[model samples]
Target: MDSNAMATDSTSGPTANETEQDGRVDEHNGPGKVVYEYEDPAYRVFVDTLNYLEPEEIEQVLAAYRFGEKAHQGQTRLSGEPYITHPLAVAGALAEWRMDAPAIIAALLHDVMEDTSVSKAEIAERFGKQVADLVDGLSKLDRIEFQSYQDAQAENFRKMLMAMATDLRIVLIKLADRRHNLQTMAPVRPDKRRRIAHETLEIYAPIATRLGLNNISRQLQDLSFKHIYPMRFRVLTRAVKAVRGNRRELLSKILDGIRSKLQESNIEAGVFGREKSLYSIYHKMVDKHLSFSQVLDIYGFRVIVRDVPTCYLALGALHSRYKPVPGKFKDYIAIPKANGYQSLHTTLIGPYGTPIEIQIRTQSMHHLAEEGIASHWLYKDSEESGADLQVKTHKWLQSLLELQGASGDSSEFLEHVKVDLFPDEVYVFTPKGKILALPRGATVIDFAYAVHTDIGHRCVAARIDHELIPLSAELNNGNQVEIITAPHANPNPAWLNYVKTSRARSKIRQFLKAIQQDSSSALGENMLNQELQALGVVPSEIPAAVWERVIRDSGKKSRREILTDIGLGRSLAAVFARRLVANDEVPQNEVSESKPLVIRGTEGMAVQLAPCCQPIPGDPIVGLLRNGQGLRIHTHACQATRKSRTTEPQNWINVEWEPDPDQCFDVRIRVTAKKVRGLLGRVATGISQAGANIEHVNMDGKKPGLFIDLHFLVQVSGRPHLAALMRSLRRIPDVVRIVREQE
Candidate 1:
């Protein structure tokens, strides 16, 4: 007999009104209405679940239950029932799914630490450290204040996931807890109900699906849909009922035909019709833009046999009897899904051209499809299969750890996890014939990371089916991919635009951050050295003690960090140099004079020449020290600079052009020419002869046989080159006028 059936509550210690007999609890007639009587049904369900556990394990579960019952003795749920009933319901669900004894105990005590005064240490002392730790992982940090409700929720979720990474049981218990909560949310306020339901749909449902718990995922989705859109749920529910009535005869005929054919082939199988979940039908309607009648697969069938070989045989038998739909067959048993889902799915053309979807699987596979990772505990004696499942689950959780390390914050980590949750996978192969499954839109970079982190970091090119392709190429199913890596190659920021997987995005972001830090440090050092030279002090000659003092004063770690800040425009080098040299000790002549700002087109990212006026060599340019942005050179005639001159005069600095500019710049020009066949040709020829390349051209083609306004974006060395080009264009026969365009 299970000890849970005999255990008494520790606090109340078996009240006189309560009686325990024959492994059952009964309440006698009393002055007050008995809450225990109301809870007897749930207690019986819990007692029935103990048959799956060993005699020794049953004692441990009873201890946990007694402790939880005492901890939550006076507490009541939102439904005005004893709080013990909630935990009991969650434990019952886990038991029905055949979860391990430890998991069941953890589910019973999941809320103890958060709601009661009980400590993890006490639970650890009473029930072992494993149960205590699981309860701790499920408990949220409710007392801490957060910036917002969303922030608190995100942090709580992050903590839960981190704990889940350590032990997969934490998440399983959490799913059970959430399932029970979602099932009993009718008494909640409307706004709160919608919030909780939406979160379940978005976060928990996807997690359940990813963990291969399809039954729980589907139930969560349907429950959440009912709360989120009650009207749509009702309308769809009625419509499905109507459809079921209309299709009863057709579904019965299909089932009978499949059963008769299998029997004739001496195959014993169970054939049954499966209706699509309401949430699934609603999702299909919204995503595929289909009406209620357009969904043909609403009524499908599942065929379960004894073993894997029989599963294939059933598929063959079904295909022979009915015409199979082309390109609608998938053999998941040969290659199980990432979530360990295996089945043979095929669609057939039924009578009157109706499409009937069918799923064939073995008995064990069917169990796994419903319970997912939890199915391992159903047969606890089979340790080998349990270990195999653990290995696969560990690999997926390890990837989550990688994502967390690469992500910037908790919110970003959550977003990346969301991206990985719903996987419409496309399987591809490597050069060695090893297969990898990725999301449908996954690219070559995603494949490289799926192979290894080093390969992803150094991925420079790829070969799809032995043909060279760009990195942004989307991978197709069954394609052979070969990634080409170079030692010096690095991730490009542009790759983030197309890379689909969270792993690739996270890794690329990490690489970009490291590169930016290195570049900023180098630039900051250069700026500080230049400033020190102006102060008559060599940077290398500075004493270590003085440098340490400066670092301490600036609240920075080292000279490199300070310099990096300077280079990144986060700090001013001149201000720091003045402090380092002591303003009074510096020469007055050097302190009073301003340094001349130099402009070269090759300064790269540190100096940007504004595109508004397109400042180039020989143009009057002014440098503006925009906050956190190193020198921005703008033309004198530019309206943006003119506006800034009034609002922020101190930010403006004088800048001059280099003597011999090597880089070309774009300048726009307008040419008013007569409408003629050869006019455009002559203008283009003149500009070409002047050694200016036309980057782009726009003509006023709205009116015919009139003066045409031709705008050309031409490449030139400086203002002199542009002037010469304009002069040359004016010399054309049909050219009436020509001038440089400015903004």
Candidate 2:
């Protein structure tokens, strides 16, 4: 049995909670005193909240709490409370939200294994599988590691996001856990408090908002705000008090008027005046660098209704009573935020010209907005109901799990997640009248992709509200979108430079890279084919049965798969092809007589033509290896002698060109015009006429066109043969600058 529930025995090894509470008794006895209690305040509260649960659930939770209590016997928290008190408190918080049996039970055990000797299997065997999974989620990553202490914090944030993506409740439980710790944070060393506070402000608060837990979000924000900016938090708190002091009666009047208006309109609503949390106010002041007096919209009203339509009616009524601030209105009802919050938000100037923000939503939306992800658990009516809510929230929560699947690293996942978790949203409509929720500043491309990956990849154009626009055009709220897609269209590399969501970026990069690797493999295979054919074995002679046997021998996936592997330089194509070709079952003499293609340059050196000779494929060449990379092939007469070769002689190697190299090579040739008009075009024509593809040409006028070096990468034969080709260009009278890089 767990010790948190009613239990008798107190003797145990040292535990934080039980030990701290028994400190006084320990002083009388000695260190390591076994201190047991009748029942902790946290568990008492937890047991009290179990009235809504079935008798079985009550027993289950009670047993787990007691077991946890026993496991934590003699343990004390940093706050000197029984260590069981923390888990009990976490359970109490979840119970207050009216969570189901599993969650409540999980809360009771969340800290057991994380801070104690209890293992996940122990919890599973004692409680159940559901409870254990929840507990496991609340546990930190197996370990935290970093390149440096500074990076450890970043990794913590990284890990937290990764965990939250799978089970949002894990984060909620953590938040509740932190809230309790923060409440008792004074007992913790001061040095750690500020860092925790800053982390809370930056990560937890935003997540709370994303979860639609406004109440918790506000508290976490305020606590973090005070710690991160103590002076500012104090000043803002005082300023808010002063502002409310003068406007207390006016605020009452406004609240009363709103209440009265709703009543008169026959709309049931819960209306209340809300001053922004001190932390939020502090952040606003510091972040915007504004004075206390300048932050006029410090207080607002929240009007929660019973149904979705009532939310809009309430909004209309409020807008009529107060002059709305133009362009400040947002209708989240039609397009809920990424966090599943739905409402109508509008800012208005009251009779005193004070800007007041009003949020109108159904009671359910209000629940979600305030509780965020936890609202599902709190609002669940039964154990089965709680499971269903988990299913529902899981749909959203689980995406965090998949978001990281395609990401190259945790940081990539974090980037996409941060964007998706942004609190604000814009509602755009499809031409068919369906509303799609997109982040603010989302473009048509984002919308197209958000619909479906296939649609996104094939999207060529978009028509927004009957106007054709660029794919990257930012979509405005309420614009009707029509996507133009083509079956043949593929994702472009350019899309990667601007895509916002992690999904879109990952998918695009995956596709483009796959294509590139495919092409590379094809090129490598073709080169290997020519090499093999020279070995006198007909590739076709390799029967399918024999090819399969060879592939099995090589331990490769398949021929195409293997070819792609070789193209990416992952495998040696020459070696693999020889193996496959030798098993062809072809004629013996035919195989023996085939000649091997000679490749120039020593292995793993930089391949560059000797600029002095400008050697081509048909030219005799040698290989000279450079360090780190394979041998480089250069023409014999290339003027560029290696500086690294002489100094780093160990890096040098031999080189030679393939007798029949199959690929085109770029070589630069200079040409001088007779200063004739259109001479550049004619020179280009002459180069094109020489059976060589001109890669690039430069005809600059530094010496007033007296001479010009038009660098043209042209195809040619050996050094002597390329010399003859340049001699052919010299006959054109426009060839004033005739130098074949024989430097």
Candidate 3:
């Protein structure tokens, strides 16, 4: 019988003594009493998978199935099958992994709460709390209104992850649910099918891989591939089958060789021929730009051994028989994958110079690789075999909580989760010899964040293999990294361009947002106070009622929000100040102009020196109140703002530089120098001698015949320092002309 078909077609009726019964009758049913006589074909087919469970446990699962069947009596799927069949199939899938009774029960009723009138309390009363919670976690947040489909999807994902964090079985059941959906997605519309396929291929497949459910992950990918690109999938499937047929003799020979070698070494193992999934084949072909022939590792062998030590012994035997390909061997047994998958992988040159891939691992490791967290019944507290796998899975789940807390919204949280799901890990080391596995292309900042969020926040530079490297440097396998942090150092916004890990990106964003809010609030308060003082009013003397009236009229939640809005330039500070004093019965004089705000270059996100002019201290400047973006400062003669100043006069605010600024400001300078050897070096040396650092250099080579125009973005303290640097550059004989550049 087809495994997926839930005995939907009736057969001969049950007979006396059960000799020729259509379905297997439970021996547990008392004499003259039949709890379930296979009347429900779905239940009959599903019962066959419960052989591993005790009689009472199977009865409980059957009970849940009956409840779901009754609840979904009138409902049918897109496939036109009774809705109960769907849950039964999901439960059967989980049962293949030997999941506990509660998980199976949850699977059997995963959709009741969402599609029917059954409540969580009712399910809890019927089955139990654990099963009810799993079903709830697997349910979608459809009833809760959201602005868009993306919002609803992100919220549902977030909710599911939170539930998974508490009990990992939720993810297992959810994966099974998704798997069954993909299998029966033909009846779904084409547009919806494509969307679901894309989502499954992008998200659920990677998630399954992360959990080390290699078998299920492959199935999900292949099913998604079939729906998303039916033509490619069909073409690829035919091609792979044809190739397999042509190489059947070669495959048998390789399998025989592996078996003989393992037996000769007395390594007692099971060697099986493995074929790459169609989706994997297509992925490899597209990713590597390879043709069918170029994908040499499409056919491989998996050697399952009795224990860890024998795995290596069998690998040696296989290598002794065939010439091992150079640099094609990996010892995952020593340092397992982040998902706790352990295998010794090697490639050998088979007959006719074709490459043969071989993976040798213990039977236990193989089981874990196939079933992932579901391989061991986590409900049982004392499963020592899966202890390491549980720990790794737990750590990943815990990070979801952290990401959820740090994220500003559901969509942002979903993006972070996606970033973490596709981890092609590269293992590195800490200074103290502790091994850390990070996603491929992860940088030093990612490492610091992986170590701890606080470390990532304060990280400045790193020493990789005892040599100082930039924090954005990509770490490699086996590199020992030591983070160099400073108490005063802050996360640079530019780090977002290179940090690969989600934790680092989220933490950096979180920190920058916090500092921005603080700075904007302070700036808003200062601006308001200055404006009030110009009107001869003291800010402190404003009564509570007056402040409340202004806040209410502004449509803001509290005083701090108003201040933040004002500081962010979303609201004019003068308008709010006038409103605050409007209700106050204070003696007021003609409102004189407010004193100019000082530009100290230390206001963090609240004050952004416009890149167009790159204003330095001592340069006359004006602040443009950009809505929601805080004050953008520009030099008085900046060409970029010249049109804006006249067109939007309300946005321009009076601003002046402080007498002494604590930080350097970037200024651009254009230098026309003779195109001669070492001319650029001499100019750089002159600028360095003048106490300025060149942040960037750009050469305008459009019409250069003998002279080259070099634009240098240099950091200087103030105008005097910039002038001195220009003077030093002018002393160079090759320098034709030098001018401070501005838009």
Best by lDDT: 3
Tens digits of lDDT, candidate 1, 491-570: 88799999888888898898877776776576567667667777777677676777777789989988888876776678
- For TM-score, candidate 2 versus 3, the one ahead is 3
lDDT, candidates in the order shown: 0.80, 0.66, 0.83
Decreasing TM-score order of the candidates: 3, 1, 2
lDDT at 101 for candidate 2? 82
Candidate number that wins on lDDT, 2 or 3? 3
Task: Quantify how close model 1 is to the true structure by its C-alpha RMSD in Å.
Answer: 6.5
| Candidate 2 structure quality by residue, lDDT tens digits, 1-743 | 12122222343322322322311122454332323344455445456667677665665666676677776777676555667777777778888887788877887778667666777777777777777787776665436565664455445566666666655666777778877766666665566778788767767777777666779888887777666667877776777778889988888888898898888888998888887877766668778999878888788899988877788888888777888889998776666566666678899887677788888877666666677666655664223423443564566556666665666665566566676666356678888898887777787877887788898889999999999998888877788999999999988778776666656676777676566656545544554565567666566666788778867887877787666655444555567766766652754334443343355321111234444555566655554433222234555445575565568654333434655554555566766556667777777676666666776666566666455566666765445545666766777876675765445
Q: Model 3, 1-743: lDDT tens per residue?
A: 01122233222211112232323335766322234455776665577767777767866766676566666776666666776778888888888777889999888888777767778888887778888898898888868999998999899899999999999998888888888888887777788878888988878888889988888999999999998999999888889889989989988888888788878888888889989999888889899999988898888899988888788788888889999999889999899998888899999998889899999987778878787777776223325547888899999999889999999999999999999998788999998889998889999999998898889888988999999998878989889999998998888999999988888899999999999989999889988888898988878888888887778887899998888888998888888877877764655667776799876977889988898888899898888988889989988998888888999999888888889887898999999988889877889899999989989998877864988999898999999999889888999999999999888
- Model 3 error, position 8 (Å): 21
Name the lDDT of candidate 2: 0.66
Candidate 1's error at 392, in angstroms?
Answer: 3.7
Error of 1 at 512 (Å): 2.1
> Number of backbone collisions per candidate, in order?
0, 59, 0
* Per-model C-alpha RMSD: 6.5, 8.9, 5.4
State candidate 1's TM-score.
0.83
